[model samples]
Target: MDPYAWSWNPEGLVVLLLAAGYVAALRRYPTPWWRPACFGVAMVLLLAVSVSPLHMLAMQYLLTVHLFQNVVLAEWAPLLVVLGLPPALAAAIARPSAMRLLTHPALALPVWLANYMIWHLPWVYDTALEHPSSLLHLEHALYFLTGLALWWSVVQDAPHELRAGTRAAVVFGAFVLVSPIGLVMALIPRAIYGFYVDAPKRLWGLSALQDQQLAGVLMALEQAVVFFAILAFWFARFFAEEDRREEIDRSPEAA
Candidate 1:
C-alpha cells in the first residue's frame, strides 16, 4: 500500500464532500454570484498544492515540497476556507446544546491558542515529516481545527461585532508570533530534518540551503501578505465609517 494514497483517495473525497455541502448550504442564502466563485478559486489553489500532481512532483524535493504544503495548509488554505463562511454550515450542524459547548468562550480560547502552540513545536513538526501517514494526519487535524476556531471568532455568522481594529491587531499579532519560527529555520546552518537532507532535489539548481532559504522566504512573505491585507481592509473600513459619521454629524437635523 502506498503511504500517500490516502491523500488522493480520502483527502480528495473529503474536499469534494465539503465543497458540495458548502454549495448546498449557500442555497438558502442569497449569496452573490461572485462569492462562490472566489471560494472555488481558493479551493483550487489549495488542493493544487496538497493533492494534485504539483504536490506529487514537488515531494521529490522533500524540503521545498513540505514547506509549500505547510504554507498552503496553515495559511492560504485556512484563510480562504474561513473567508467562505463555512461556519454557517457549522451553525447548521450543532444543536443548541452542542453549539454552546463548541463555541463556549472558556473552552474555545484556550483550545485555539493551545492548538497553535502544539503544531509549531520543532519536535512535532519533525515527527510529522518522518511519519507522514500517521503523525501528519494529527498535524493536519490540528491545523484545521485551530483554523476553524480562529476564523469563527472573527467571521462566524453570529450577532457580534468584530471591531476592525481588533481584527487587524489579531492578524498582525499572529504574524509576529509565527515569524520567529521562520527566523529559527533560516538561521540554522544544517538541515534540521534528515528526510529532507536525504531526498533528491527535483527543482532547478537549488541546493538544500537554497531550498531552506526559499521556505523561509515563503513563510515570511505569506504572513506579510495575509496580515497586511487584513490590516488594510480594516483601516479602509475604519476610515469609511468615520467619513459617514462626519457626514451624519454635519446635517442640520440635530439643531
Candidate 2:
C-alpha cells in the first residue's frame, strides 16, 4: 500500500488550509504577543504531526504514531485553537446573520453534540483509517469545527452569551458525557481497527494495548484540562460580577 498514494493528499491539503487559516487569523486579530506566538508554536507542532512527512513515516510503522495522530487531531490541536480564540476570523465570518444562526438555541447545541457522537463511533473511526485520505479529511474538519463550536460557547469573549455558571456547567457536562467514549476505547479488548493492528510499533516501546491506553490518557487529560480551565474562569467571572453588584448596591444613589 502506497502510504502517500493520494491517500494522504486530502490530509495534506487540510494541513495547508489550517496553517493558512492560522496566519489569516493572526493578521486579523492582532493578538497579544504571547497568545499568538504560543498558538503559532502549537499549530506548527500539530501540523507537523498530522500532515508532515514525519507523520507519514511514523504511520507506516508504529501504533504509537497512530495514537499520536489521534491525540494531535482530537485533543492538542483543538485545545490550542480554542485558546487562540481566533476572534478576528470568527468575528469576520460571523456576520450578524451567521451569529444569529450559530446562537440559535435550537440549532447550536444539538449539532455540536451530534457531531461529537458521529465521529467517535468505532465504525466511523475505522472507515477513516481504511480510506486514509478523504474520510480522514472529513473527520478532521468535523472534529475541528465541533471543537470550535464547543469552545466558542464556553470560552469566547462574546456578548450576550450564556452566563459564567452556565458555561461552566456546559463544559463540565460535555466532559461527563464524553467519558463513556473514552472508557469504551480503553476497555475494548481486541484491536477495534485493523489499521493499528497492522501498523509497525515504535517510540516508547508501546504495544497496541499500551498505545490505546495512552490514547485514553490523552483524551482524559484533555477533558480534565478543558473542564477545569472553564470552571476556573467561570468562578472568577461569577465572583467579579457579584463584587460589582455589591459595589453598585452600596453607591450613594442607592443609599
TM-score of each: 0.79, 0.77
TM-score of 1: 0.79
Best by lDDT: 2
Per-residue error for 173 in candidate 1, Å, reads 1.1
lDDT for model 2 comes to: 0.64
lDDT of 1: 0.63
Q: Please give the CA lDDT of all the candidate structures.
A: 0.63, 0.64
Instruction: Identify the runs in model 2 with alpha carbons over 4 angstroms from their true place.
Output: 1-10, 17-29, 57-68, 85-89, 103-110, 200-205, 252-254
Q: Model 2 reaches what TM-score against the true structure? A: 0.77
> What C-alpha root-mean-square deviation, in Å, does candidate 1 show against the real structure?
3.9
Q: Put down candidate 1 lDDT per residue, 64-102, tens digits, no spaces.
A: 566666666666666666566544554654336655554
Residue 190, model 1: lDDT of: 66
Q: Which portions of model 1 miss their true places by more than 4 Å?
A: 1-7, 57-60, 86-117, 156-159, 200-203, 243-254
